[model samples]
Target: MTADDTVNQPSIALNSEVSAKCNEVVEEYRAGTASKVDAILRLQSIIPRSDDTEDQFKSALQSYVGMLDSADQARASAAKRGEQHDRSSSKRPRSPPESDDEDISEKPAKRSIDESRLPWVIDELLHPIELPPSLRLTRESLQLWSSNPKQYKASLTNAARCPEFPDSEWSNIIESKPINLDIVFAGHYSTSFDNRRTEKLGELELTFGETKPSKRIESAGDWLIAWTKASEALQFAFPHRERELREYGSYVTQLFGAVHPSRHHRVLQYEKAIRRRVSARRDLSLTDFSRFADLHLLHIDSSGAVALDEDSRPQARPNRGGDSRKRPGKGVEACRRWNEGRCPVDAARCRYTHICSTCRSREHTAEQCTNRARAN
Candidate 1:
């Protein structure tokens, strides 16, 4: 492989020995017997034990996962607070009570940059990509980059790579977050070369990319930089950004693919894919997003449905089977008609899965999901 080729390592499938261990780790995770990092470390290891396995796992996951349990607990607490506010508000009757339209109006409007513009992928949660990233791979530039100690060392770190290449670094190089080497080598930079920064940033564009890039300072990298700000990769510092980036990346990943994820179906399929790439591995690319114009991740199924074969003929089963040991991101969404007791189709012939609508697990229905019980 060429020196620059190291930045794009292909996914290495598990060998028989590693596969056996993978099964154990995945099983432990499904049974809740293993912490996410613990299960991750088990699969990541080529050997059964290592002095630094856990440390390395944490360091890698820290790139985007944040403090796993702590973040979950914080979200759980916020959910509780929202519930309490709702309950107390319901108990307080207004003089004549608000009309339905007024009530709906009081509900927060969709987050947007303005009244006229379509909802952007960037906001407080997401910054905007200003320039297209380095393009051309010019011979002179390549020679200079190869010789520079800083760039040579950067190839080993995640911050120098795309997607997970930190937004923080655009503002401050010293604060670039640490990411796993596996993720560092993942982005298909060649794919995104065609995606240009159409929007103008004037003088500010230079701050995000090389001066005069794209003959106008703005380019694809700058645009991606904007999208990256709202990305899930930034969730550790901006907790509210998580859902927005997930929805955005998940959309891009499944955009042109068959068996698109069910956004309105309330299944965990897309969410889990986002979690696997961004949450589990700190990978920012969503499933070959750059294949068309965005991100891609290893083992991340943009199809958001079960593959019965290589052609990805989607199965009719309920649940994309999202939590399988063989693939990290696959799941069948619950059949909306069946969930509503309106589908006349048999379970064996339904278009969607018969799994739990909330968690997407086959173990229980949405009514029986733990979150529902807890809320009750």
Candidate 2:
């Protein structure tokens, strides 16, 4: 055959091969063997090399996919309306009606199904495209996917394909809470100070010296700076101290309130600093650092036992007896330990009253004191 004839013959053979694949797909659909989406994907995989034929195949596949999508929507709508349709109503059977018993299945089974399918679905959705090296699947991302599967599936799937994706991070994501680090750190530090002060007081008394006065925390900003500095110092002196602080911080934050933006930023900075320091000594993997940096602090109470102002600074605890209408004699006596600046007891568990710092008396704070001038 001539050169022109040879070229034309291969074009004809390619068209025939494409036609055969299309026919096979049609047969699969007619036999109810493959789903519409599956059939379309199959056709996509076998598109001819010719641009014209490829364009035609894509156009036809697009139209077919659209029809499949519409049918899915109709099926979902019917299900929501409680309409019982025959399984054989469509060329491809709809998934069996989920039995109520499905909900009653063991928690482990349900969790297993989720854990297995989530990564696979994510992989399929985000194939050939991956997430940035810095980002990983966080608890927030998992929650978002779990809450709105249809809405966030695309994004989650993309994130799942990230090279830095932590497959084992799912467990952590499931268990982690959006903890308020500042409040947690505050409680931890408060308790630590109390313990240390008691020890120091005992030492001073034995030496016939007076106990040192407590350092008053003027504002939330000041408190945060002090706590951050202390944490840095502790972590510097004892390498394991960082992990302990994180554990305590996570526990406190989860128990008390949501993470404040300022506190969250500071914690991230602290973690980054630690990572930098560690990397200097030994090569740090992005995976390890991501795991270390994964502070699951999202979706918590806006306000908790510890309150914060709009500026994300911790608000001073309200005075226990600020109301002018209350009788002074009926007021509870303040805890002497608390007044001396460190209450060893848990704030909530403590039986004694929390006194206002501005006034020594439990009757009122300086803000509400009628005898403010006299006291001054």
Candidate 3:
């Protein structure tokens, strides 16, 4: 044979031998004995004249076994993960019964302070001064708004309002009308009477059980003035409840008052302002379609053997410029967006409409199939 013929003959024999040996190793690996590497080495050693052919074949076989073992381990791990997921899913908290009666039965009784005695206590404390109608509240507001009605009433009376006087000037006042027991007990007030004078009056009243006629009535002019200003400021803050304003005001009173007495008024004011601003603004919610479209804005690099078309192309060759356009390996080529034997953009416009090439039918390429795509 000529030199070229002899070279060609050896190449052909070598290719055939390699193919057969690869097949043998694969079969052995599948059988779980004599490992892929051993089988391949045994095949190569049969041709002793070939230098390190056994070693080369063993290396390749090892690589193949590694890939197969990795895949098998992944599958087993996935199955184990799925089993754990199922167990966790079954362990979720069961929802409680939904009916109002069921909810009521399940809940422990609330510790409610006696609201029946609230008004009377309030009246006694604020004696001789008629409570403003603003101090009165509906049953729902009363129960829901304050844990302690007496304290709630006092805070409401002290809330910031127009014409706020500093705490300095305050005193007792003569009766403008019959004293409201509610205002006396639960409300804040000041009296201008001296302790000695008050004691003398008390002693006289108690001893005689009657008042002498023509007794001089001492005036609490400064005290009355201070009380008037303070009361006005307090009352303005706690305005008479209209239905719409009641809920917001009551909520403010309950939460802020209970948690922060000194800052309660300021907090309520700020929170109300914020709510107003929010209400004035528009609301928007993005749908799934819009969200998906937004992802396309991200940058992507596509350097591969496959072109925009699914057809495989020859590996990229470097240009004269010396910049290499690397051809994607088999593993890398697995991650591209396609559908129904076409790209995403093309599939959307195609007459057949997009379908999973791998799962739905045999005609389309598996690479372009939606159903065959594995989630990362």
Candidate 4:
């Protein structure tokens, strides 16, 4: 054989080997056998030095190095973000629930949530007992956002979802929003994976608690989780709409339902407050249609329930649901806003029949609760 043909064979064989290795990595990654980190290291190990690589091997070497660099960069970006998340989460202490008997500390409070001696929050975030396939959320949405920040911004803006906060406002926008659900679907960029992980630890950054402002976002995460979980509840609550979005009308309601998290958040919040314990969600009574699936604001007051839309009233109410509890009488009622520990400044004049928020007595506020004092 010619000397030239003999020389070319080895390079071709080596190039094929390199390509084969890369293909193996792709398969392992896709099959979930190898982690991104593992895959990166494997690719990096085979990359040759450009300076010493033979001319034939140079092209393959550059390709190898290029992949190695990209994987390293992606790995670093993801790791940095993971560290940030770890640092942020580690700051939260899982101390026992707060007690009235405990001494007040001059030191900074761990969080803003006033746990216990209150009405309720789900033991954990509540998802509907069953989930529909359409509502299955994944990181793909965030991936799209990450690949093109501008596209994410415009889509979120057009959908009326909050865009990622600017660096300046990131720390303090928790209170700028009315409720945690307002930012329930809030997305943030991960430098490690260059991902915009949505609703998946999304709360590490902020919260939408109607009850408290965030400091370390621990309480905010809880609040955000509570609100975020309501998405599935809404879907389960409204079958007609779910069916419409799937089978009938403009999918506008469905699109908005999935995208507009706060509206559902508010509806569920109201339902929880109104029902107190044992939410049967009877008769779509939980739905505040004005806000539910509505694409635009309509001179609405979020403070209390608004009138049902006439056009929607006939068609909107679900005919039946699980059994409901009796409405609380005015005199025996518990004020949820008061229990939240974030009652508006004008609460004294607030309309509602009332008993003590702490002890369920009519005599006085929780601090001065006559029943507790008597028991003590």
Candidate 5:
């Protein structure tokens, strides 16, 4: 055959193979060996195409199967009539268009988007600018303004006459007394007084000695106002001593001292509890329970306690219970879990030696094995 004929022959063979597979699948479905849906899937797997084409293959397969059903019935009826009757016209199947319409109705149409208009669409983009924090005019600034009444009043009047001062702003300021003389001076004055001026004025000198009791009583009038001023000046003058001054004539110190111990204890206890919890969690995750399955410890010391496993090696452990040996001379076996004659000792000062059954490795006793060390 020519090359063209050979290619065509393969195509025909492929079509025949696909048809045979489809028939085998339909037979499986009819025999109750496989469901109709699974048969459709098996038929689709034999074809080389995407998932979208599977439905089309299923429709064609179903139409062919329906034709086979009709042919079987026609043959059965024809055999009974023999050649005496001809039912060719009556037996002819309907056109496939109706079946195609039924399949098309079962599948919904997919919608596609138009991408051409995407670039022309306008989107509103917002750029937000955060205003820097407005400078806070403190009581110090207002105090300065109050000290210089003329300057303070002039500044307020100028601000009120400015175009930026709206009617609402003016009314609110006027009603609420917004222009505090102290805060105005706070804004104008430097954080520190110039040392040059104080030195020049000879006001740098301070009288430290205490005056008479009568004079102390006399200064009470101005003292009240000075003491009642805001935290800024008091903090500046006294530094760390201000909080003590603020709590003057109150039980602040006594109260603090009274509850301080309990508070300290509570805080320490909470920290210890947290540490224990974290350690317990870590131990739980790292612990190998399987390794300790057969672990047993024998204790044979009186003054101290040690663990010994079947290996006969000693391992140190924390002391929870009191010493087992009542007298320093009395022999002791302190491992509560000790079984049979095996006894362990605290390796720190343990004198006697013993053996372990499970681990076979030997050193101090049954209580001292490394495996028991890890186990208990």
Candidate 6:
């Protein structure tokens, strides 16, 4: 109607336009086509054209951005928790058999090594060894050794002749003594022999004959022990077919239940053990043995610690002695006492060179120097 009213009318129209734009942004956000950042940007653009004061615009923008940030953090935390739960669930061991249907008997029989001659072989090998009465082989130990006769034979023969433990002492230890599972599974402890008992057990699925109904293992431990015996039998019977043995070992795990994925290394160890044993028995020429010895020494010098690579092969690490060059030099001062004969000090605690000042030799101090003695 008047000059002031005319100016206010356009301001009212601009505020309505800004309000409409704000509402459009809110709808776009709700529909999920636009993100919270886009919504905030849209809201900020509207603030410049709106009727609101500068302070009010600033306050509103800060509040909205803070709310959006809090919501985003909450979503991220929930997603992280869900991922962790999924990882743990995946790692949990498979549940035990739900019914008798899952029992070992229900599985289809597969062709395996024949161990019928195991008893005869074991008896023939061990009968001549004059073991102390205390160390007489039990049925269980005999069964375990039957798996790897070559290793067991080597171990038993060596144990019988071990000079460190006399027959009388061995007899005393084993007399009325229960069979040591450690000895049974590992054979006798020897610094020279690398025990592959655990690895041998893992390869049981590939090595031994079909699981007999009579020997249906009731527990996982017993099942593992039986497999160890089977692995040994397999090794003894087929020493040369390593590639086939490895493929069969992997296939066996797929067919039969495995111990655990974490323990899969045990199966790999068996392969290494077999290779080492096979290498030992195969008569190599002096030159070949020398080459192997050199390679082994190189492996030792390469690294102090042993580790497997991606291919499950042992990787010889490069020597880490280079790090020693970067270390700080010793800051010890010369010992004044070591230069005098009267100074009573131990070599380790005395940080200085013990050379005599008069003779410039380490054997005696200045006071005890032969030149000084002669001059006096």
lDDT of each: 0.38, 0.42, 0.36, 0.38, 0.35, 0.42
Error of 4 at 44 (Å): 26
> Measured by TM-score, how close is model 3 to the native structure?
0.18
Q: Model 3, 1-376: lDDT tens per residue?
A: 3323423456557445544554555556556666545654554443223243445434444444454465457568989999988998989777877778987577676666533223233222222234334333322344443456445445644656434332211111111111221122212332322222222452263222211111111122322332244344433433443432434344433544454333232333333333333223222111112332222222111222212222243443565678543323332222123331223232212223233334543223454345566641
Candidate that scores best on TM-score: 2
Q: TM-score of predicted model 2?
A: 0.24
Query: Candidate 6 on 261-338: residue-level lDDT in tens?
Result: 433333333323333433343232112233344333322222212222223543333335644111112333334665
C-alpha lDDT of residue 179 in model 1: 31
Cα lDDT tens digits, model 1, 144-170, are 544453553354344433334422232
Using TM-score as the measure, name the better of candidate 2 and candidate 6.
2
Q: Whole-model lDDT, candidate 3? A: 0.36
TM-score of each: 0.19, 0.24, 0.18, 0.19, 0.15, 0.19
Worst 10 residues of 6 by lDDT: 209-218
Query: Candidate 5: lDDT over CA atoms?
Result: 0.35
User: Across residues 15-133, which tens digit of lDDT does each residue of candidate 5 receive?
Assistant: 55555665666566656587656765665465434354455444554454453454456567778787534555457665676567787577666556432212111000011123222
TM-score, candidate number 4: 0.19
Report the C-alpha lDDT of model 2 over 116-233, residue by residue, as the tens digit.
1132232222222344332223323444556655444334325543322121222222233222223334443342232222234523633222222233332344345444544443
> Between the candidate structures 2 and 5, which one is better when assessed by TM-score?
2
Reference-based lDDT, residue 111, model 6: 56
Candidate 1 global CA lDDT score: 0.38
Candidate 6 wrong stretches, greater than 4 Å: 1-27, 35-37, 48-52, 91-376
